[model samples]
Target chain A: MRIEVHLHPPFTQVVGTRTLPVELPDGASLLDLIERLRMDYPNLFPSLRSPEREEEVRSFAIFVGGGEVLPLSYKLREGEVIEIYPPLSGGVVPKLVQKTRRLIC
Target chain B: MNAGYMGKVLFVDLTRRKTWTEPLSEAWARRFIGGSGLGARYLVELSDPGVDPLGPENPLIFMNGPWTATPIPLSGRHEVVAKSPLTGIYGEADAGGHWGTALKKAGYDGVIILGASEEPVYLWIHEEGVEIRDASHLWGLDTYVVDETLRAETAKTAVTCAIGPAGENLVKIAAVMHDGRDARPAARCGLGAVMGAKKLKAIVAMGNRRPPIHDRDGLMASIKAAVPEIKRLAESLSKYGTSGRMTTIEALGDLPIRNWVQGAWKEGAERISGQRMAETILKKQYFCGACVIGCGRDVEITQGPYAGVQGAGPEYEALACLGALTVVDDLEALAYATELCNRLGLDVISTGGVIAFAIECAERGLLPAKVDGIELRWGSPEVVLALIKQIAHRQGLGALLAEGVRKASEDIGGLALEFAIHAKGLELPAHDPRAYNSLAVGYATSNRGACHLQGFSYIFERAVTLPELGYPEIQDRFGVEGKGRFVAVTQDLMCLFDSLKTCKFILFGGIKPTHLLAWFNLVNGWGWDLDRFMEAGERIFNLKRLYNVACGISRKDDTIAPRILTQRRGEGGAATNLPPFGEILSQYYEHRGWSPEGIPTEETVRRLGLEEEAGKLRAKAVMKV
Candidate 1:
């Protein structure tokens, strides 16, 4: 199976041109693909080990096609395009409340 | 109870050119709390059901909450409310930094401007008194320059909230800017236009009076306790700033793209994320008044043809809307557009939406080929920048754009109105609601229209958990049944924070839902139960609702944009799900004790102690029609 990855902003330079092919054992999942990629592009992606994050579980978000990619147990087919992304916060600082901390420098 | 507190509301009747001071009672402050609640109460007293937003009858109030100037993390915030020129509903805006604190220190809780100014002028407040000064020279200046001039003239260190050229021209989406150094905008709901419509340029305050606290020892102790959490805030926010979350919002499929006609910009979304921001222009971090969490970004675009200088950030939502959502991936250009809005005094979110809607219309051949010497195209940062300038200056192409998405569509005469992407004339923020059903209610019921802070159930709805509270789980982000319950609970919790004037970021630390109750227990010594806390929130929410109803909003108004109800994301979290907004709204109505039409029911009015007010508003609304 061959998969392509897309990155945003300045990271577009890190989006590799090489289409790495993986020999999957039957119905290997996205986690498996990520594990394989971890070996190849160790530094390009964010890992579950967030020194700042207090949670115990290795947390990350993945999406394939148009929906949020579920847990690793889900199976993947050949030649499907998957987009991996990370989480961000802070929206809405109602002026009446000014709850949002977002500001210009 | 010290002499330091203003304990009064200063009134400026621009229409009559009269001024008066209304006493602030301990009882009133105790019951209504402050900030949004106080402003809502005053607005209810000031507006008639059918009052024109731009008319002299509409009142603009700049008010601060009780906890505004204290050492609380991300505290020191204030609110502005009026009949919104943009939405024709309730207009509002809020800000932090020296402004709110200075207002309190200047010996006033808030300034209530009762009528239109007869000429261009600005309000200057010192320890002595509040005065209206000629502002004809300052009227057209950008907010930054206005702040500088005001500071220079005041000959003191007072902060300012000033309007720019767009506001001066009465652009419907104008913003009121604060913090001359960092440039914080109370930038939604067109209050700046109100300021502009009245020919008011800025409110400058410089005073030595400190805000009074009932218990200094207790306040000092609380501040000390919150310090640890505040310290940690600097690390998380200072590192990436709020733009840091763009990648995360993109990952969750929450980022709005292509005028919300699409969920993700498969072509260019990632190019504007926080990691991307850091790799490029990010320089120094900025702070609000005493805020340990310096979420403000200082960046310099020292690359390409647009090299050299920097400004504070044009931050998160603006970056998403003006940068990624419109498919305008050029960081420098979007940053420039953000700068233009600051200079022009417009809301960047609405600007982005209006411009994107235009581009979409132009792409669909809805706009005429003869539009202002150029074709508007998606992903073309130049066109976006051109429109921002046009909209700000209200030039030929900009004149139509100045009317905002709704009016622009009407003028252009196309199916463009269908893609305007607003709720009740207010543009939705950069977040896409298709990914989270809770946002449907948040956007629908937002008093100012399509706002996020009113009910920030996003954190609760997402993977971030308050485990001890036993949440409904992140997998249920799209679920409908329990949303009303979640919305109500979060609304109250947020109200308590808004009342206390605490920063929302404090929630990430140990300040859970019950923390407000604990604070009340320790301070003010109110031994109120959780039921009382929740009831206060319900009352405040209901009061705001009644205020809206007084201004002519009804069940017909609280609704989601058609795009969220009918569309599905082809590349993110909501791929297969089209939100049943009507169904969720039905539940929200039930939870809010409102009728199916989204009006507070008679039974609910009585229960919330608002039967008389509701009746009067209902009658007024009917009579207006």
Candidate 2:
């Protein structure tokens, strides 16, 4: 099955596209799609997951089908469109600061 | 004299035509800090609870924090405080520009305007002198004209904070505008009406004096260490300004659409977004004094109906309120409307809110089909522009709408109340409470009535975390548990920001309580730890709450609009979830150590060193009974 993904800024800048179509299994969960994206764009994963707790995907809010926040375990349907929004308050500060220090130093 | 402060406040009695300078009480300065906190302390000391907000006795305060005129980033801001004509409760508005810096440079920490003038007048403060000049000719002029005229009359470098015809007409939703076309407005609580009631037109400040810094070297080192990261983190914000978040907020169902009834307006959101603005009319970015993040937009409409519209561009609130909320997707028209609001000294949030409310009222036959021969319709740019004029001039339907949604809803009667979205008379900002659960509680308990900046706890739920506040990791925004404590903690921290006159956006750059405290200590030569800093914030928050209590604000008044509370968007990111308001509010009260009636308890007040404020509240309560 093919799923459509909408990426808002920083993510768009990262992924080099506003929208992307990816092929996934019919029974793929939201987490599975996230893993797929992580595999596809390794740089995007760091932003999507919490910096303090990497296992937690609390950094970005993922919405599907009319803007409902679904659980990561929720199954994705064929032709479903997923919208990923970067944190409205900006990115994770600690990691960004570390990265910024690395660049500055 | 304390370091980092001007050490004195100028008091002007318009009726007596007398000016005096009072030493800023060192004890009170330590207790309240400055800006909103210090202003609140002075307001309570000066005025009674039941005084009419627009009356001669209700003092209007323009206050600067210790950080003003300092080299600290995002320190170029000030607070305007008065009893609100709109809410009849504790009121304040914050603005970032050069005015606060100018005022500090003019050798005053704040200015307290007392009594109503028999005629129009303006204050010219330069260096160590203040002259109250006749502004009779400046009357009825727009803010732009007043700003320019005052600058011309004073020094060319003078920064003018002025009110336009909306304020002159005593519009309840009027704003005190600054920087003219590069508009920065302390645009809430209708304090501009208070200025108008005093018959004071503009305040022009010009000076070269910088507030004395205790340890300039240390403060500069700390700032230097933080500048690179602050700038890097704020890159997107610098590029797109605040409107950059439009699409993201829309995606989260946080954007108020169609008077906050609709769940989604994706295409419309994209069209008016900062990204769209950058690709269109966005000419440059505007920065405040000592600002690292330039989130202010400067745009020009060169070849459109809004061709003449230029200068400060519409921000996220303006775009959401004037564009998405009204279902008007025309970015250019929204830009024009924003400029119009600025020129007329009208609060953009309230202007958009009243316009939206009027349209909804008209839809339900609560209003006439046409007001002033112009049809009232949603998504009509011409109608929106015409209504803005009418509101500022108090012409026709504009007069009723200018009273703000709370009064206008009551006047309309019937189902009109159903659509009037406000918390305690003040209209809600662009952010919807349903999208962020913390906002529901924050809006209810906020002292200034439904202000996002007052609490700003939603930022924690979204992106940031305060390890010092016991949140080492981002908590579940959807979860109801512990949100009460979360909001209380964040609100206290936000109070510190407001008092310090620092932008809350510094949180995005990973600024912690320690950093804030370090800056405070470095500037004032005080060794306050995290606990002391947080306590000061708690004291400030409770002080404002005590003031509100004196004004008869209780648990009954601490609530969002019924529609916002009960109605579900039923689609989009926030679909089908009403905030569990009761449980969250109970936890909030428990955390705040307030009684169920939402009044600060004697023990809590005593603990925070607010015994005097509590005693005043008790006195007011006794007088009422």
Candidate 3:
């Protein structure tokens, strides 16, 4: 089965594209699709397992078909659209000051 | 003496043209923990509950917390407390800028203004003393103009908090403007209207004194420990600022769209996202005092219908209210509207909310088709901009809107209140409670009305967790279960943050309670542990709730708009969730140790050592004898 994968914001910055088509086997679960994508694009996504928890954790949110949250166990049908979001942190600030040349500079 | 405080509270009586300084009580500081907590205490003791919020008898207090003016990350904040002209209850708003730091350096822990000035005046606090100066020339100016005028008139290094024309005209949604160039606004609860009512235009403070830090080395160590994670998070925020998260928030069904008329607007969300601002209009990123995350934006619209519009860009709330809520996809126009709000000293959330409410009313023919020859319609940028001026100037239809959605709808009549979308008189911010169940209770019980910062339960529901407090990183956002207890606990935690004058952004960076406790001990030499600090937080929360109860707020006031409680997204991620508000409110009241009417039981009141304060409420006839 063929499904389209869309990335939002900084994820698009990392992946260099907003939308992409992925070839998946019919009846593949959402986690299976994620695993396949992880193998294909190793550096694009953060790990689902948290370093602190030593178990699976959700760093980014996933939405299916017009911003609906579906479980990873849900089966993926052909031509369905899935959007993968990047890990969002707090509102604006920076760490150490680079007095000479900052990020904006 | 504790290390982190100036131990002086300044009192300025505008009516008498007099100023006095009183040494702060150590016992009071220990119990209140400064900032909003201390400010609330002063308001309770000094002002009457039945006093008109816009009257001179109501005192406006500015307070700094123990962490303020220190090198602690995100600590350059102050709380503005007053009897809310909008909510007619306990009101507080926090702002980040250099003004708070300047005030702290000028040898003051807090300032209380009482009585109205017969003529316009501004207070100048220098090394020697504070002087009430004539502000007749600065009257009728915009916020930025007032800021610039004050800086020019005072020393160049002086930081000023000024009111714009909206405040001067007593617009109910007016917000106090802080910082000059970037223009940070303490834009909540209509405190600006309170200031305007006092005929106070600006407060300029400049000094070189710093609060004595008891353990500088320990404070440095605490900050160093949190720096790396803070830097990483800050970098992410610097890329997009607050507006960049529009798409993600929209995806969660948390972003308000078309004034809560629709569920999803993917294309519109993208058009107004922070990424779009960075690529198109952003000239530079703005940062508050000592903020490493620098989530503020400075944008310039060089060309477009809004060409030459240049100033602070839209934050998430502004983007949601001015852009998405009205379906105005033209980013430049929305940016211009945001600039106008800052200039007029208007709260963007309330401005957007009131305008959206007005548009919804006009669509239903409840309002005139054209007000002063300006047609009212969704996506009409001119009308939005025009109405902002109107609200600030109290002109035409803007006069009605300046009173806020609750009053505006009441005046408009005919099913308008059904869609006004406010908890009390204050308009709702951008977040939809239906997306996160805790937010529903947070909004209903917020002392200053429908406010997000009061609890920020959404952050707990989605992004972060307090593992030390046993709250998992993420709670079930759509579920109604466990929300009441969660809201109550988090409200206390956030109240502590507010009292400390620390920015809530640090919580997202995984700052723990231990870190906060360490800062308090090191700076103030209080030696408070986590439990003790949290108890103070709870005490502060309950005290503010008691203040509201004194103002005649009760269980009936702990309610959300009927539209939010009854309506569902019907599609999208928030679908099928109508927010069981009644159940959540009941649980919240019980968890808060309040009676079913949302009044603190005598047992709970005495346990928090607020029995005297509660008794005062009864003495003032704000409570039943």
Candidate 4:
């Protein structure tokens, strides 16, 4: 299955493309797509996961079906456009910036 | 003299042309803690509740905090408090710029203006003394021109806060702007109308001396501890300015769309975002005095219709109210509107709000087809720009809009009141209550009438935390539980911040209550623990509530637009939520120790040392005991 990903700023600059089509295996969850992106772009998602349990991750607010979704266990349909936002959601940049410092440490 | 305060307040009686300096007592400083608290203390003592807010009897008080003009980052702020001409309640607006610092340096803790001037005049404050000068010439100029002309006449280094024609015209949504093009407005509360009614043109402040600090080393340590996080926050802010998070706000459905009638405007958000501004018209970043996070924008449209349109902001609030709410995706036009508001000294939030309300009325044929011959419609950038000027000048249909949404809607009658989004007569700022459940309660209960900054629980609702305030963990913005307590706690915290004249952005830098207490102690030499600091905040909050009670505002006044309470968004994070406002408001009353009617209990007042205010408020009978 193929998913359409719309990258927002900073992430857009990081990925070098505004819109990218990524190929994913069938039955892949939203977390699967995030994990693959994190693997490919190591620097981008340094603080993307919960420290206590690395498998548990926070994805960019997923905007699909004309609304935002948590994307965890959210099954994707064919031709679904997912906006994988940076952890920077709504003026929450300060928190994310602080989180980045902790992750680096 | 206290270590932090200049220990003197300047009193100017405009009618008699008398200027005198009175020593500010140490006990007063300890009790009120300056800025909003001190200003309100003065206002309550001097002005009567029934006094017209635009009348000569209403005193305009300017106050600075202990941290103001110090090495403390984000301390260059001042509060303007008066009986609001707009809301008719406790009205206070905080502004960032050099004026507050300069005023403090000029050997005064605050300035209280009593009686309106018979002629247009400007107040000049220097280290030498205070002078009430003839300013008949400066009365009609734009704020930028007044700033320039005053700086050229008074010392070049002097900082000035002035009102433009909107203020002079007595437009209820007018603002008192500071520092010209890098304008910082004490725009809330419609204080500019009060200033205009006073016949004051501008205030010029220049002083070289810094206020004394009790423990410089200790304060430095606190600042140093907070610097790393401050630097990180500043980096992001400087890169994108305040609207840096525009896309995220839109995605989260926090931004108001189409006059709060519709939601889901990602394309509009993208066009007016900070990223787009930075990519296109952003000329440079600007900063307030002693500010670490330079979230201010200086932009000019280099090409297109709004070419050479240069000014300060289109902040996230402006972008939402002027852009998304009006459905005008033209960023340049929005920027031009921002520039116009700054120049004319109008509050962008209220101005945009009033204009959006008018657009909605026009669509329904409630408004005249041609407002001074200009068509009113949604996404009509040209009409929006023209309406702003007409409002400032108070010309024709603009005169009705100048009275603000509540009055305008009342005049228009019929269905207009249903969509007139205001509380207690003051217009709401950009953030939508639907996005964050806590805001619904916060907005309804805010002392200063639908102000977001009065109790910015939305920040905490999103992700911010303060363990000292008892919330160790972040709460869900969508959840309904615990929000009543959340609004109560955050309102108290914000009251302290407002009293201190500290920037709310400092919260983003991870500064906690401990750091703030430490700095206050070091600066003022008054050693107070966290509990005591919080006690003062509680007292101040109650004091303002008491002030409102005296003004006849009761539980009935703590409300929002009907549409917000009933309407659900079609799409977005808050798609299904039509804020449980009443339920949360009841919970808030419980946490606040207030009666279900929203009057502070005797026990609560006694605990916070607000017995005097409690007694007065009880006598009013407006506060249910």
Which lDDT tens digits does candidate 3 get at residues B1-625? 5888898989999999999999987887899889999999998899778899998899999999878888888899999999999888999999998889899999999899999998899999977999999999999988788887888888888998999999999999999989865778899999999999999999999888888998887677667757666655445566688776788788888888878878888889888888888889999988777777788898888775789877788888998998888888888888899989998899999999999998888888898878799888988888889999999999999999999999888998889989998988888999999888888889999888999889988877766666657674467777777789889888888999999888887765556665677777878877777788888999999888888887888888888888888888766668667788888888888887888888889889988999877877767747562
The residue ranges of model 2 lying beyond 4 angstroms of the native Cα positions read A1-3, A8-18, A23-80, A92-105, B620-625
For each candidate, the DockQ is 0.14, 0.28, 0.19, 0.17
Q: What tens-digit string does per-residue lDDT give for candidate 1 at B320-388?
A: 888765787877777777777777788888888888887888788887544787677778877877888
User: How big is the positional error of residue B596 in model 4, measured in Å on the Cα after superposition?
Assistant: 1.4
lDDT of each: 0.70, 0.86, 0.82, 0.81
lDDT over C-alpha atoms for residue B341 of model 3: 93
| Candidate number achieving the greatest lDDT relative to the actual structure | 2
- Regions of model 4 farther than 4 Å from truth: A1-4, A21-39, A42-82, A86-105, B616-625
Model 2, range B394-468, lDDT digits (tens) per residue? 999989998999999999899998888999999999988888899998998999888898888877766667876
Q: After superposition, how far is residue B353 of candidate 3 from its true place, in Å?
A: 0.9
Better of 1 and 4 by TM-score: 4
C-alpha TM-score for every candidate:
0.86, 0.93, 0.93, 0.92
Runs in model 3 with CA error above 4 Å?
A1-3, A22-80, A90-105, B623-625
Of candidate 3 chain B, the 10-residue stretch with the lowest lDDT total is: B228-237
Worst 10 residues of 1 chain B by lDDT: B466-475
* Residue B192 alpha-carbon offset, candidate 1, angstroms: 1.0
Candidate 3 structure quality by residue, lDDT tens digits, A1-105: 999998887678766898989998888888777778777776555433232221122334344555555556778989989887644443212122221112112
